[model samples]
Target: MLSVDNLVASYNAGPVLQGVSLSVQAGEVVALLGRNGVGKSTLLRTLVGLVPSWNGSIRIDGTPLAPIATHDIARMGMALVPQGRGIIGKLSVADNLRAAMRAAGSRPALSIDQAIAPFPALREKLPAMAGTLSGGQQQQLAIARAMVGRPKVLLLDEPSEGVQPNIVQQIGQLVRKLADESGLAILIVEQNLELALATANRCIVMAKGRIVHSGPPDEFRNEAVLRRHLAL
Candidate 1:
């Protein structure tokens, strides 16, 4: 359960998220869809404390989160898989996962095997250098590392970036399955329409840093409706 009310944030002189409000219920996956620079990524960054919130509130299971450090937010049951998979090139995939558990700091967490279970391909690649892996593999590693912390809410920003279509489809299926089985609330900012509509239980559309429409995936599938927002 994650809640954000009247959330506002800025970058230097210009405002990005203008009084945004949204919520993602447990066991649900909500896809954030919008064109480039509509503040979809900014909202995710702000929720995780990477970007300072100029106003409003963010709560995890009713616990207020703001004026909090990024690492502290991760410890408080929130994990972020950023736009670009931020894996250390020199570190092995196993070490990357271990680092996440360490940050969890004695919190009930998932073992390396359990974390990599969703990604069977990753099981064998654990000993491989993260930098040498393919783009899709790197994305899987990023998400698996985040899951090692057993977060209550997962903020995934553009998981499909640089990944192949088939792999993107696989990830969408995995995300849907992960939400149902683990009851982890997920808010994903995705540019890929097919993946978002396929995986998400609900879809929220953004424009000019504000949420303009919220509906079921079918609503967003309409060509006319999609054109109004995305023009694809």
Candidate 2:
């Protein structure tokens, strides 16, 4: 479980997240949607402690996380697969996965085979250099790396970006499986509305650093609601 209460953050330009609030429960998947510069990504960064919160609180399983170190946050049962698929290009696929398992500390490490089970393509590319893989493969590696951490809450920032349509669909299925089977609470920041709606059980739309709308995926069926909040 995760809770963000009136969360606020700012960059050099000015405040980017202002009094944003939301929550995710175990086995639940929530989609964060908005136009450019609406603080969707900043919220994820703040949750992971990559960006400091200016105000408000972030709690995991009822434990406050805002003042903790980024690594400490990860150790507390949260993992982030960032937008760019931050894989270690020089490392082999297997090595990348192994490194993440080690970083998970006391949590049970997912074996290489188990980690790549959802991503069969990664099985054959175990010895290949991560940088040598296509964007989609690299994305799979990113998610696989996070999976090895055995996180209670997974924060995904634009998992579908730069991925092909087929791969995007696979990513959605994988997310659903993770939540349904693993009971992992997930928050996905996505520009791809279709993927967001397809994967998330509920949707939250943000604007100018605050949440303006929250509802089930079916809310998108109303053209006015979709356009008013997401400008879709």
Candidate 3:
């Protein structure tokens, strides 16, 4: 569903992703794993055009995406739930979901009620201000908001970070459901190895801004592979 070839990207100081390449098939979940500051998030941002690629090509479906703006990328069926949840703090839960739907430029296949079904806590809080929610609740809101867009490929950056264990597990289950039932291709950047293994069908490990390992989830369970590419 998505393919990236020899992707390179950088900020003012220097490059953060160098010659990275990967692909996500339809209805598959791919986990992007790495220790802190290894450019996992940068690669996602570059793919969706939030950060411009210095070199390389990114294609969604069969069309090149390198020239599109980030908003255009969303219209092309990609949704990003960034690291911080990126929720509009002052907006009500319903408004947040509505905004995402509007931004995507189409009615979501999953309605707001259905999107929040997996997150029961969020359902009761739809009228509440997003800023008033706890970290876990906000994370749920973020995921729900993304679901409201009905993206073909969902890019999630550390959805488990700062969330409670129970909520994290719930999020993992939702990720699997999205891939299995809804046929959404998921690319998640996660530091939580257990969550990644449980949620994603494949794993890509990065080090020093390059992919060091790319294989099925079981291949990443090897002690040697984890130590070499992701050990802190």
Candidate 4:
């Protein structure tokens, strides 16, 4: 479980996250959606310690995580699949998975083969350069790599950014499956309405660095709701 309370963070003293508070319980996938410049990404970055929070607390399973070290956060069972997927493009697919496990500095929760089990495409591309894979494949590698650590809380910035529609569908299914089967606590900031609606158990809308709306994914299906909160 991940809990953030009154989290306020800034870059160079200009506040971005203003008292943002939210929590993700085990087996829950909470989708964060809003227009750009609303601080969705900043919230995720602050959670992982990439951005410093001037106030509030972040706790994992009731354990406080100071906004100081990213590595320490990861080691404490929090993994991030950032906006760009952040894979080592030059490395082979298998090597990418190995690198993540190595970075953890201990035995990973899942072996390389177990990590790649969900992605059949990735299994066949083990020997190929990671850079050569499509954006969708690279996203898969990114998720698989993060899973090698068996994080209790997973933060995904945007998993369907450059992928095709069908692949996006697959990813949505996989994300939901992971939560259902492994009880992973997930926080995903997704602009793709379909993916968010299909994958998340609930949706929250962010505005000017704070949560303004919270509801089941179906509420977002109303066009008026989308236009009112998301400006779509």
Q: Rate the local accuracy (lDDT) of all candidates.
A: 0.91, 0.91, 0.88, 0.91
The estimated TM-scores of all candidates read: 0.97, 0.97, 0.95, 0.96
Candidate 2 local lDDT, 1-232, one digit each (tens): 9999999898766889989989999999999988998888888889999998889999989999988999889887899999899999999999999989865769888999999998988899999999999999999999999989899999999998899999999999999889999999999998888899999999998999999889999888689988788777
lDDT of 3 by residue, 73-116 (tens): 88888889999999999999988988887555664456788879
**Candidate 4: misplaced stretches above 4 Å?**
102-107
Candidate 4 lDDT, tens digit per residue, 1-232? 8999999999886799999989999999999999999999999999999999999999999999975598888878899999988999999999999887744546456788899999989888999999999999999999999999888899999999998999999999999999999999999999899999999999999999999999999999999999999999
Ten contiguous residues with the weakest lDDT in model 4 = 100-109
Q: Score candidate 3 by TM-score against the native.
A: 0.95
Model 1 lDDT tens row, 1-232:
9999999998777889998999999999999999998999899999988889999999999999988888888899899999998887799999999888955755877899999988999998989989999999999999999899989999999999999999999999999998999999999999888899999999998889899899999998789999997877
TM-score attained by model 2: 0.97
Error of 3 at 191 (Å): 0.7
Clashes of each: 0, 0, 0, 0
